[model samples]
Target: MQKIAIIDYNMGNLHSVERAVSHAAAGNATVAITSDPDMILKADRVVFPGQGAARDCMRELETRGMAEVVREVIQTKPFLGICMGMQVLMQHSEENGGIECLGLYEGNVRYFGTVHQDIGVRLKIPQMGWNQVWQQMEHPLWKGIPDGARFYFVHSYYVEPQTPDLIAGSTEYGISYASAIARDNVFAIQAHPEKSADDGLKLLGNFVAWQP
Candidate 1:
């Protein structure tokens, strides 16, 4: 059986993610929420999920010595990053008054301001609701999901991948931003599949069965 490890650096909603992955797996795989680098490396797949501020997240990751572990795992396994997990994959973030990130992907995370000049409308900082995610490129994880499916989003910052081709999904809040990215064996999204219901579960199921 395949072993999937959800990296628990004390920065994510681990239990909710575990339950969601479990439901999605349907007994096809074993999921473990672990902080040990060795155990994470041993897993066939890794899920990196995070919540809270970027500075604090980075602090915890560095302090726990999980940063290098994440870098190593992403290069070799089928990896998935969620929400803040997706944010930190970039080189830097404008969050927490600007902080450096993992630099795994060439990009930066920017804040969605209180207003969008292009749309000429006042917008909320934290876009906390279901938003339409448009598929930008073909990938295995998007298998059964529709082109313009809605996913649960609760984030103020969005990623801007340096390489446009890496963007697998896009969503518009003030402006359309890269909401999901995929390259090689890495796939990350700036939404919560755990709270996204049917389509979310389908995506998670696809990940469980995905070979890349």
Candidate 2:
């Protein structure tokens, strides 16, 4: 049986993610919500999900010594990062007054400040609703999910990957930005698939079946 570990560092909505993954797996895999580094490393797949402040999240991972474990796992397995999980993968963040991040990917996370569309209409920060995602490239996680599917988003910050090729998907709040990024075995999203309804479930299901 496949083992999927949802890393629990007290920074994310762990139970909700657990439930979503369970539902998506549908008796095909064993899912565990754990903070233990060994268990996370042992799993066939790893999911890093989080919400809240980036500084607090980084501190928790360091405090629990899961940082190295996460670094190792992402290199070895089919890994998925959600929201803050994706932000932390970048080299730095403009959040928390500019903090350093995991540096796994060449990018920076920036706060969405005073967004204005082409028509000069102001959009709210923390984009707390469904937004359309345009697939930038073909990826396994995009399997069965439509080209312009809407996903649930609840964040004031977004990732800016150094290379355009790393972007798997893009979305516009006031401007277009990388909503999803993937390279090798790692795929991360700035939105919450757990809360994205049908399209989200399809993404999670794709991840469960991904060989990657």
Candidate 3:
């Protein structure tokens, strides 16, 4: 049984994610939904999930003494970030007056802006519900998942990775954004895998069996 720590940053859906991992790992996995640094460092695998503004999430992480802990996890262990969790890995974000982030990845978060706003097509800014993701490349993190599988997404901001090959999959929302990424020990996703049904479970299962 893998010790998967589902980080409780107070900004993401934590419980369901833990459950999904438990099912995927097929073992007596432990899920700790806490901001405690010690618990995070002790875990075999760390999962960072988010569902809010990037700036606020960073603020909470810093306040909870998780900033340094997360930095260490990504530096030394297999780490996964989701949604705003992925955005926080970048050098900075333009979410609220341009705040600095964890600097794990060399890129900035950007919005859809007026590209779709003025066209009157009115594609939802948050990009909610299920969407198919085309596999940009092969990644061990996506072992059992097929190419162009549908996953659930709900976010207004998206990642534009400087290392494009780090991107494992992409989803279209007027424009394409990196929906899944894998860079050495670090893995991230813009979609909520825990909510994507069987496909999501398979993705989690792959992550559980993946090697850093």
Candidate 4:
């Protein structure tokens, strides 16, 4: 049984992630609502879920002393980041007055700009709705999942991985964005698989059964 850890650093949507993992039937899993580095270091897999500003997330991560632990997790274990969780993995975020991030990936989180509002109705900034992601790469985490699958998404800023190969899937808002990413032991999805229906469950299940 893989010991999956759903990191809880006072971000958003922790319980739903846990429920989704349970729905995937992972034999061994725990939701670490604490900031303990040892728990994360010991876990076989880690899921970083967030629903807020990139800067705030970074602040909390640092406040809880999980920043270094997160960096260490990406260095060793299989990691998955959801929404803003995906944003923080990058080098920096241009949110809440520009903040530095974990730098696990080379890109930064930026606003969609003039074409989109920071927050509001109709093509909103937060992007609070369901969107489809087209699979772009072949990886174990996406195993058995077909292309053009709809996943729940809610964010103002989206990710743009440094290279094309790191992109596992993509979704379009005012523009097409990197909806998912994978590199080595790091795996991240801009969409909330926990709320994405059957395809989402399959994706989570694949993660549970994934090796390397």
- What lDDT does the true structure give each of the candidates? 0.93, 0.93, 0.83, 0.81
Q: Which stretches in model 3 have alpha-carbon errors above 4 Å? A: 117-121
lDDT of 4 by residue, 1-212 (tens): 55778888898978888889877855555444445678778988888888887767888999999888888888887788888888888887778878888888888677776336544425656787788899888889778777887888877777767778878888888777888988888889988899989988998888877778
- TM for candidate 3 is 0.93
Please give me the total number of clashing residue pairs in predicted model 2. Answer: 0
Per-candidate TM-scores read 0.97, 0.96, 0.93, 0.91
**lDDT tens per residue, model 1, 1-212:** 99999999999789999999999999999999999999999999999999999999999999999999999999999999999999999999988889999999998998787236556777897999999999999999999899999999999889989999999999988788999999999999999999999999999999999997
Error of 2 at 100 (Å): 0.4
Off by over 4 Å in 4: 26-33, 114-122
Clashing pairs in 4: 126-155
Over 148-199, each residue of candidate 3 has an lDDT whose tens digit, in order, gives 8899988777787788877878988887778878788888889988999998
Looking at model 3, residue 110 earns an lDDT score of: 76
Residue 80 accuracy (lDDT) in model 4: 82
Q: Rank the candidates by TM-score, best first.
A: 1, 2, 3, 4
